[model samples]
Target: MIKTNTIKSVGLKVPALTFGASGIGNLFHKLSNADAIGIAEGAIEMGWHAFDVAPHYGSSLAEIRLGLALRTLDRDEFVLSTKVGRLLMPRQESGLQNGEEFYDENPFNRVYDYSYDGIMRSYEDSIRRLGTRRIDILYVHDIGKYAHGDIPQEREYFKTLCNSGFKALEELKKSGHIKAYGIGANETEIMMEAMDYTDMDVVLLANRYNMLEPNRDEFFAKCEKRNVSVAAAAVFASGVLVKKNISEGHYEYGKVPKKVFARVVEISKVCDRHDVPIGAAAIQFPLRNKNVVSVVCGVTSIEQVRKNYEWAQWDIPECLWKELAEIGIK
Candidate 1:
């Protein structure tokens, strides 16, 4: 069995395998509430008690569905984390519509706001949507260049967060509204910059610290120094590390670049010689980093959840790490 890890700030014990709610939000395809709820319940039965969701995920559908699915389960038995930044607003039009960002989802629009009022409102909205008293971990969602794209504009917005948003989070934590506070970003630089404003209890970094791209040692070292735990999300590089072929792979939610494809192919060759499933090695790689507390994997089906569990516990030889280093992976 995969062992659970502790998040010191919240005094919550989480599985080494955390379930991400994006897939249940119908990230790519249409998913019924029953199916999505079934997947969440299945994950809980399979021993995943730490779950992460964002309002931006299916525009509040994920949180609402998660709340319904977990309603019967003892709330104290699980650790729930949700992101704040994109506030969900009811759609101006009343008729059924397609989702612009999230596939087929509820009729809601996302407004990007990271100010004090915005953060507090988003938190309250999440609580109501989740039907939960308190969220174990709260992340300031997508405040950096990766999500916003305009570097200068995002810099100003980030300053707004440092000035107001961080204060709101601190107030929430102090008031027992939230257990811990941090940032959920796809880049490493954002966390480093966030440290300049305030100390963080947790960081949800996605697609940046896997075997194919492990150039985060310095940031991990600083996180260790600050005693901030990390939840490694999208550890498969959005599918590149786990897919059977490069043609079917995706990197950072987009097509795999030629150079990256070549590198993964090389790594796959090494894995082949060692008789290790590349997916197993990929999922297990982040846990080897001392700063990483859990790997938050997205699942759309029970099979994916079970596969993740199996890969997390897969026995890997020490020589595989050495072989990876021998290649130009560094």
Candidate 2:
């Protein structure tokens, strides 16, 4: 079984590893129903009961599939989280929505809604799609410049979140609709800005505080000081850290840049010298900080699930971390 820790701000104990549902959402590729459900069931069997999904993933397809898998299990046996901000609307014509990363998605177009009513509606819709009474952790998804770019609309969305959306999250916690609420974002700057606006119980930070890029010390320190827990996602840096060859992996969901590939090559060499799998080191890196409660990783197959579990459990010598530190990977 994976170890568990309490998210002190919310008093929720989650596994050190969270099953990110993007894979089942058909990110980059499609999956058969059997395959999607099997991956969820397999993860549960492996004692990975904490799951994080978003409506933005396959426009609720992932939530639907995950619900099917979890329907038979005791609801109390697992911790569930899902994101808001992107409400699903029925698409009139659908083959593929433009600019979407998910493949073979459900026939729904996503609308970015960050108002009070939008958050409440999004939460209720997620509950129905997930077939759950309440979500343990509710995140406001992609409310930053990373998703919206450095535009005036970005500030408008942030204003909506600060002025009205945050009230919805606070009310949900008070009403027991959700245990905790925070922002689920890939960037750290906006999250830091949000810290000044409201008291968030947790933050689902992705790609910012992982093995390949671990220079978010100031952000993690702020989270720790504010008593805000962090759920670290994209710990693989979108598969770059785990790939055998640096060129074969991706960084930030795109082609690996030359400098990043070079850095990973260096990190990989150090891990090889220590007789350690670079993937294992990646899986275990973020948890070194006290405030990070979970490392969320997405997997598309049962084999990938098994591999991640093994990597998460792998033992790396302490000297390896020192070596990585020398190479500016700490």
Candidate 3:
């Protein structure tokens, strides 16, 4: 069985591997209700009861589908989390295009609002969509320059979060509306800056602490020092680490660059020599770090869910880590 860890500050014990809900929201392909619920049920059966969802997923389809999946389960049996930032507003005249990769989703364009009122409205909306009485964790989603290409706009949003949005999260936590609150960002610098603004219990750091980009040692060290636990999201580096051929898949949600591809090739060679799947190594790498409490992976089908569970549990030789360090993945 997969293990679990406690985020002591929030008093939540989550599975070592949390299920990411993006794929169930019909990312890239349309998903039937049965298929989405079945995959989630399969993950629960396999002992992964923690799930992470967002309004941005499948044009707000992820939270709805996850709600349907967990409707019958007792609330205390699992841990649930969703992000607040993008508010889904229903349009009276419907002609909105779904998310770029999402097909056949609902008609609603997300409005990015991080004000106090916006955060409260987003939280209440998420509760309705998720069909849950309370959320265990709430994250301020995509508040970094990496997510918002405009640096000045990102800075302004960060300031808004510090000045007003953070109060809503803290109030929710204190009032028992949410157990923990933090910023869900893909970059480390902004998270460090967030620490200066507010005391967060957890941070969902995505795509940065993976096998290809293990450059956040200092960041993790600082988090440890501050007693801020981190959850690893996008641990497969978006796709390259898990794909059968590294070149066939994208990295950091886009085409892979030559320098990054070269490093992955070396890591792949070492995995081949050790008779270990690269996916197994990638899924296991973050758990070895002291600061990472959980690793979340996105899955669409039951087969993918099973494969991810198996990969997470797969055995890797200690020598592979040494070899990877030699290849510059350290």
Candidate 4:
């Protein structure tokens, strides 16, 4: 069994493992509501006190299902984080569940909606969907994604929110509605940019700085110097680490490319030499930094959740780190 580590920084006690809610929504494929809730319960039973979800995930139903499962627990037992900057429009000609985004029939099809009104509207909708008076953490999701042909505009919008968004969040925070303010993006440079806009307490670096492509030294250095807690995610690199191309492997992430499979093969060799399962290495790899307060991964079933936790019993030996270091990811 993996002994859960609880971290305390900046007066906030964050769990070492956060179950990313994307798998519940089948962000990798398609999932049903019951399976999602079961995994949520499994995570809690295993000591994961924090769960991160976003409106972009399954049209925000992930949070709703989380809310439903959480209602079965004492609300104070865990932390719930969600994101804004993606608006929920009135369910269009199709219906509430079938609204359009940029004229797409899928209501979950999200475009950047970071205008102040749009950001606030998204927060309000998340509040209703979560069925909570306030959230523990609220992040500005993917301010880096381009929609209006100008990536700078999306950034500028987030900058404005970082300035004013904190003030608004302060109101909620003071009311005990929210715990922290920060940014969550699959990209890294935007997280670097967010430090200037808000008094960020934590940053979610999702898969941007993992073993396959570790190019986040500057970001991690700045975070360490500034006492910012980094929640490193996507450690599996979108299933590239598992290398399903191997006839014996089990993971299937959309479709695995050949080179990704080759690189993962190299990684598996190193892990085997160091006596670590590739999957175990994937779970523990993100916490290499002291500032990485947690690692977030998605699991579809209770069994999957247990498998992820089992990896915590092992750690990469320094020999493995040295070998991985030679691969030149500083």
Please give, for residues 148-224, the per-residue lDDT of candidate 2 as tens digits: 99999999999999999999999999999889889999998988899999999999998988877788879988888
TM-scores for all candidates: the values are 0.94, 0.97, 0.94, 0.85
RMSD (CA, Å), each prediction = 2.0, 1.3, 1.8, 3.8
Task: State the local distance difference test value for candidate 2.
Answer: 0.89
Off by over 4 Å in 4: 1-9, 93-111, 145-152, 246-255
Alpha-carbon lDDT, every model: 0.85, 0.89, 0.86, 0.70
Q: In candidate 4, what are the lDDT values of residues 48-100, reduced to their tens digit?
A: 77788888777776777777767766777777789987775545554434232
Give every collision pair in model 1.
Answer: none
Model 2 segments beyond 4 Å from truth?
98-100
Q: Write the residue-wise lDDT of candidate 1 on 1-330 in tens digits.
A: 678887765665777888899988887667899999999998888877788999988888899988888886798888899999987777888653446436778888778889999999999999999999889899998888899997688888898899999999999999988888899998889898898789889899988888777888789888888878999999888888777666784687767888888778788889999999888888888888867789989888899989988888999999998888787444
Question: Pairing residues by index, what is the TM-score of model 1?
Answer: 0.94
Question: Model 1 lDDT vs. the true structure?
Answer: 0.85
Better-scoring candidate (lDDT), 1 or 4:
1
| Model 1 misplacement above 4 A | 8-11, 93-101, 328-330
Candidate 3 residues 177-209, lDDT tens each? 999988888899889888888889999998989
Tell how far residue 123 is off in model 1, in angstroms.
Answer: 0.9
Best by TM-score: 2
